[model samples]
Target: MAHPERDTDSAAGTGGDPGSWPARQAPGARDLAGLDARICRCRACPRLVEWREEAARTKRRAFADWDYWARPVPGFGPPDAAMAIVGLAPAAHGANRTGRMFTGDRSGDFLYAALYAVGLASQPTATHRGDGLELRGVRITAPVHCAPPANRPTPGERDTCRPWLARELTLLRPTLRSVVVLGAFGWQAVLPALAAAGWRVPRPRPVFAHGARTTLRAADGGAPLGLFGCYHVSQQNTFTGRLTPDMLAEVLRGAAEAAGLPVAHAD
Candidate 1:
């Protein structure tokens, strides 16, 4: 269901700056491996820091026996990913508990299923960080690292955490050809981050809508990157049919194809 702009010359290996993503000049290049480590120790926002820690301490009855990550959830997948998925933030009982995006949550269950069906994911269930789920060519990240209260991040919280997302994109710009935004919030957050990281943004910007697609470049000389929009795979949406399996699959499949990933391959 992606719009026509999903595939472009930039995504076809002509994308990326001549040395657009040099190893040394990227946003915190020496820190990509250690990025997650730093994120986990962040206490930048007083409100989020307190909320995430308190939730970890007062464990939900269903997860009383579990030890929560209680820190920022870093992006997961290969460093040279061709495709990326961005979300709003971590779920209090989901990534906060399992230390992996969408892991140990119903929302994850729904998404992983679709990713698996399209051959992007190694498994359909992400039970834990060690559950062995693998993404073939896609990476998952979030605009906000920590879990926010009521699943809502204040404007300040989002801006405060954007550096992480921007840095990740800068590092991945060399190979990332497409991005799938999980919600409108993510769509809004990623645009500026990409532009700041050197991706060109059209004047007036593109509107967020299900199946909407846009193409931009890292810079005038950099490769073009495709952006696709999809409804968030939240329980309210899934349970109410706002986002159905078919709908999710349609978007992910289109993204994978644009990123030059095969629909099915035995691994």
Candidate 2:
């Protein structure tokens, strides 16, 4: 749906350095925890909330009455990670139900496999947040914290939810060495944040091609954070060969090296 080349000026509201955007950073780290609490019980958009609840209540047409998770999915990974993987949002019955980012979906299947293959994740199973799976130095989060109708959240909703994402990055600052953006939307959501923080955006922007890497200077400290862009391994991509396990693994390998972690070659 989102391609990197699509001019972002319309979506971002400004084509220049994002530092000019009017939004302010979250009040403090305490704001982060408070935002988390709100996310857990958010009913900001009544229509979407009702739709999500309805989806969970209804059985899959073919499956009749199968269980579904239809709630706010939270970010997951090692608390002290140097890298954070940013995704778009939760799949209807996937992370929304499981309460963890990128779980219980085809996208997640490919991603977790790559994460495990590269040793960033200790376990392949991401069925639940507490599945004993751990990311060595990586955390996974989404731009839209709440699941949206038909897997798409509106621009207003995304903007409303932007503060949560900002808070996450802010609280995880100093420790974050790099970020792996899983799709164009992920890149878009983060670029402005980086700009607002006074970071240098990569020339040509961060392209969405798999395994592409861009080095950026942090706004706060001028530290370099290697930004890696990748095509999302969504069902559309993986099943159609638009994304492959090996390809994704290569990106992970590069990201690991960028994060100063030991890299392992794919078998």
Candidate 3:
């Protein structure tokens, strides 16, 4: 189903300039909705722009009948979320097709099921943008918004996309008190963004591990933020038993509690 919230048609256009739109517009966004709109309209990275459009044009056979979102997948969840879940990037046949982060893919299946088990999600499935799935006290976003070729975004692309994540962190700073990063890539990518968003990262950056935890002090003497690391929900981890349902649920429950949200005990 085509997401009514996305402008897939006009998404291909550069909106007056290709490589300079994000830095020029991201900071000026006063609200999450405005930031999301600007994010979806960005065409700052030529390589990512071409790859996402190609995937949309010659889509997977299973979704040939479906219209791919083909644009930058915006962060999903309420603006006042107390916790944020950071991931690597959008999956090509997943969010790149369904227009919602972590939707239409097995990775999403694992992540959402864990969230539901921990009492943080409204549903255990997320197949599309309109699937009635909602996250409580948490938001999901990525370092790179567009789907990259071969599931690996170059270092240049990652740096170019930093402004969007930095701006998102700024918007969520009011209520965000905890973060769960789902891989080393997202961990490294998010630390700098967190510092840029007004949190003072420790001098020696914390290392990434399945159960690593760190505390960041707010630069302006506001509330402290807890950062947790977990294995990515990619098939490589879940299928190999490197990350299990029980394990994921435990981490999410811990993070939710750290954010001051009431978490139900998993059965």
Top-scoring candidate (lDDT) = 3
Provide the global lDDT of candidate 2 against the true structure: 0.70
Taking every candidate in turn, the Cα RMSD to the unseen true structure, in Å, is: 10.4, 8.7, 3.2
TM-score of 2: 0.82
Work out the TM-score per prediction. Answer: 0.88, 0.82, 0.94
Candidate 1 local Cα displacement, residue 3, angstroms = 40
True lDDT of residue 106, candidate 1: 93
Residue ranges of candidate 2 with Cα displaced over 4 Å: 1-28, 31-35, 59-69, 202-204
Off by over 4 Å in 3: 1-17
lDDT of 3 by residue, 28-133 (tens): 7777887898788788889998899999999999999989999999999999999999999998899999999999999999999999888899999999987899
Model 3 scores a TM of 0.94
Candidate 3, residue 234: CA error in Å?
0.5
Q: Taking the tens digit of each residue's C-alpha lDDT, what string does model 2 give over 1-267?
A: 122223323333244433222132233335334445435544455555677677677746743454565666656766567888998888777776666788876788789888988888887767766688888889898877667787777877677667667767776776777888888877888886666545688677766667778788876665688889889878878899988888888887887888888766865
- Worst 10-residue lDDT window for candidate 1 reads 1-10
Candidate number that wins on lDDT, 2 or 3: 3
On the 0 to 100 scale, the lDDT of residue 24 in model 2 is 27
lDDT of 1 by residue, 1-267 (tens): 112223222331134432222121224434456556545555667788789999999989999999998888888888889999998899989999999988988999999999998899998899998788898999999998889999999888788777778888887888899999999999999998888778898989999999999988668587788899999999989999999998999999888888999996323
Off by over 4 Å in 1: 1-26, 29-31, 265-267
Give per-residue lDDT, candidate 2, residue 92: 72
